[model samples]
Target: MEIQSTKKLVFLLLFLPIIYTTAQPLIHHHLTILNDKAALLAFKDAITEDSQAVLADWQNSSNVCNFTGVVCNYQQNRVEQLRLNGGGIHGPLSPFLSNLTGLRLLDLSENNLVGPIPPELSSLWRLNELNLFGNLLHGPIPDSLSLLSGLFFIDLKGNHLTGIIPSSILYNCTSLGYIDLSENALHGEIPPEIGNRLLSLMFLQLYSNNLSGKLPPSLSNCTILKWLDVENNSLSGELPTQTVSRWKLLELLLLSNNLFTSHDHNTNLAPFFSALSNCTHLQGIELAGMGLGGQLPTTIDQLGMNLSSIYLQDNQIFGSIPPTIVNLSNLMVLNLSSNLLNGTIPDKIGRLQNLQSLILANNLLIGPIPPSIGQIDRLSQLDLSKNRLSGEVPGNLGNLTLLSDLFLQENKLSGISPSIGRCESLNKLDVSFNRLTAIPKEIFGLTLMENFLNLSHNLINGPLPLELSNMKSVHEIDLSSNSFHGSIFPQLEGCAAARMINLSHNSLEGKLPSMLELPENLESLDISFNSLSGEIPVSLGGSLSLVQLNLSYNDFNGPIPTSGRFTNFTSLSFLGNPHICGSIPGVPVCK
Candidate 1:
């Protein structure tokens, strides 16, 4: 009986040691799960694998919890926050993140993660903020993300994600304050039910997508919604006038590059702006390129005075220049081009002292230009071409030294004001289709000119001005369809750098100027419809860059120059000269 009792005691003692051995590892697993090792690995996985040195010292070190971009809860050693933002890491996100149960904040934004978000992240129910923006992740957002009930901010913008945004995720996130999915491939109509549910949402950005359909009227439920941007999409139909009527706190409304058509026109906008005016903090409004057809609202100047920029280009809007527009002094850019606006530009336009860009071209505006336009010293671009504006060109325009392009073409302007020479920075000047008889030689003083200069289809009847060569910096000059008479200026040799010259439809009577050597950079030369009587310069054909030459309708009596540059020109370019013959197409061959 004593030997049997001793054997049972020995068995009991052995069982005790075995239980202790297994329990030790289990306790260690729980402790290590919340330790610096897990936090380091999680951070490493969030960033590029190439960032080995980021937490390298923490590797295998026992003091990793105190390292940079790591946070721990009080009393316990568990990690509650992991912030590794702005770290240049590239590669897919790690799915092992589900192991960190105590994590409340994870900011891996502005990194290089390049795969679909792991659905396993639903295990992070304690997470309050999840920012994975400015990455290369693609694919539909995870449906399990709805489980994060505590989430207040979810920013996944500036990525390549596709598919429709899941309504379950949005509708259930009642605590969400900010949701930005802009610059993505998310498509499909925004669900009205979701908008109705997420009343706490403040910012909703879904711009730069292929999403189509009308905006959800249920958005009005979000009383705190401040910003809503849906620009550069395929959305159509009338704007959500009903939504604006309800949400008076809305600040920014950008609906550019959409097919939003307005049936009510002036009245439809009245409700939108009237409701918008209630939100006194409203600072921005953009509705450009929407195919909206209506008159420029006369009362718009009084509305939205805080607005800094207004884009109304690429529409069918028509009407006269509203005198009230002079009141919008805070406006920086007012683009009203490509419209059907008529009547003279109101003199009151000078009142927009802060205006920078005033684009009103492609309209039917008539009468003389107002000298008040010179008062806009800050003006950068002024396009008023393709109009019926007549009278002398204003000399006061010289005050606009910052002017880059002056397009007064196809107008009835009668005189060329010498003040144009004062626009030292002018790059492009087109005053074609006018009734001017002569141009002031002072215009040649703009030696810094580099773009194009056109003065065609006028009644000017004088010799090609000798000062024309003083424009040595000129790239191209078009004086076609005029009545200028004289030999091609010998001083043209100074313009050896000219690229294009058009002197067609004139009564110039002289041999081609021999003193003017063949241009080295000349690309196009059109002397057709003139009485030039000289052999085609053989050197003119050898210029490798010369692409087009029209010497037809001249009185040249000689065989056409066939060497080098002439070989590329067709006979049609020299056909009208009866005494000329060449071995080119459309010309009689020399017998």
Candidate 2:
């Protein structure tokens, strides 16, 4: 019996070490899971308000892996992902999340989380994606985020983050492929250390920030880059011709609203345009409001066939609309407004059949609008206003059944064609500040004019159309500075959604229609500089939404009703009407 016991003891001693070795990792696995559970609990506690109850199951669940938005590894031992996006949870981000050492993704976007990003997040050594976008979080981006050397994507966009793009992140986070720190308060130059560093970066959106200074030339080293949006920044320097030429895979480039100058005294943009041709996949290019000078290069068509949108408005771009632009079969939106552009719009512009929005307003372009524009069946918005263009609008434009807005104001348009009424989808039509005469009867049929119907500052004559009442949902109607003669049409009261109604500076005669009831949303009314003579309508004073009123140079006599929200109106609102009387300051006292 003694010999048998000695043998068993030896066997037990040998098995004990093997058993302990095998059990060590199992013990560690449970402890790590427990730590993960604690981290999640802390996260849930940080949420002061979870109106949507997104985290309701978080507390009740026994296993942390089964909790809301938490994903565990295949072994069910560690948390790997936590996706709590757009849950309406209002709270500060918990720094305890860093304890989830094995976490690969942490997406807490579109929440109301406020406060600085916790620096402890750098401890997430295995994190691949960290998206905290669309939160109200304020303060500088934690520089220690660079410690996540293996991170591939990090988006902190739409936050209140302030400070420079840290040089450490640009220089060290080389594995990053996507970085969007846009729509924040980040200021300072993009660190030059990023030369050839972020070779895997495909997208870099730093738009709508306060970033200034010359774009580092080294950024061109990110050869695989697909999107680069640095618009709305105070960045100054010549267009980066050398830098852009290297972005062969670039798709979209928005460098607008910056202080960039063209090479060669701001007159030479050819180099920049030439460099852009290298990016065969380029689709959209927006350089608007950059104060760029020089003519639109005829070679602009070399910007690739995939290019769809080009916005170069609010600049000093001159020269005629190059017909070569029609060669880009995929072009969708072309906005060249508010520039010094002259010469007639290329008549061939209509060939861009896929075009949706075409804005050439506020330029010096003369000649009639090419009727060819109507050929773009997909055209939704067309703005050719504030130009020296003459002649009538091409009736074919009415072919655009999808047209929502057509702005031809501040031009020398001769007349409104009945064809415009064919645009049944028209939401807003502004032909103000033009020499327009003859209102097409079809205009009265545009009931979808919910935005505005402005024919002001024109030579249009004739009585106000009773058909105007058909615009039941029109927001504003301005036929002022015209020669319309007749009594104000009482049928106009049918426009119950009208907010602003201005028929001033016309030749209308007689009192306002006695049944002229104010619309529910009526805010402003101007009928001054007319020949109307009678007691002012008492309904005008009782306007609930009326804030601005003008009845000047008229022959109206009456006691202004002190009712509703119109009492705030002063004498200026009733000026030049010798018979007008009101108790409001600057108004003639009622007798």
Which numbered prediction scores highest in TM-score against the true structure? 2
* Residue ranges of candidate 2 with Cα displaced over 4 Å: 1-8, 49-52, 558-569, 580-591
Candidate 1, run of 10 with poorest lDDT:
265-274
- Candidate 2, residues 1-591: lDDT per residue as tens digits? 999999999999989999999999999998999999999989888888645367887763588878889999958589999999888889888899999999999999998998999999999999999999999999988889999999999999999999889989878889999999999999999998686688888999999999989888888888898999999999998999998999999899999999999988998778899999999999999999987998878898999899999999999888887889898889999999999989999999998999999999999999998999989999999999999989988999889999999999998889767998999999999999999878988998998779999999999999888889889989999999999999987666689899999999999999886667877888888898999988877777666778888888888888766776656877777777778677777777886
Give per-model CA RMSD.
Answer: 6.1, 2.0
User: TM-scores of all models?
Assistant: 0.76, 0.96
lDDT of 1 by residue, 1-591 (tens): 999999999998989889889798777655765454664576465665577566565555555567667687745556788787887767778877766767789888998888899998898888888989899999999999999988889989899999998888887777888888889999998776866788888888888988888888888788878888889999987767677666656677788898887658532444555555565555567778887776766777755667666777777777787887788777777877777779889887877777777877777889998878888887767777788989988888888888878888888889979998999988888888888888888787777778888889999898898888877777899999999998986666566668999999999887886445646788898989998997776756666888998988889878888787777778778767899887877778899
Question: Could you tell me the lDDT of residue 351 within candidate 1?
Answer: 73
Q: Which candidate is the best by lDDT?
A: 2
TM-score for candidate 1, please give it.
Answer: 0.76
* Model 2 pairs whose backbones collide: none
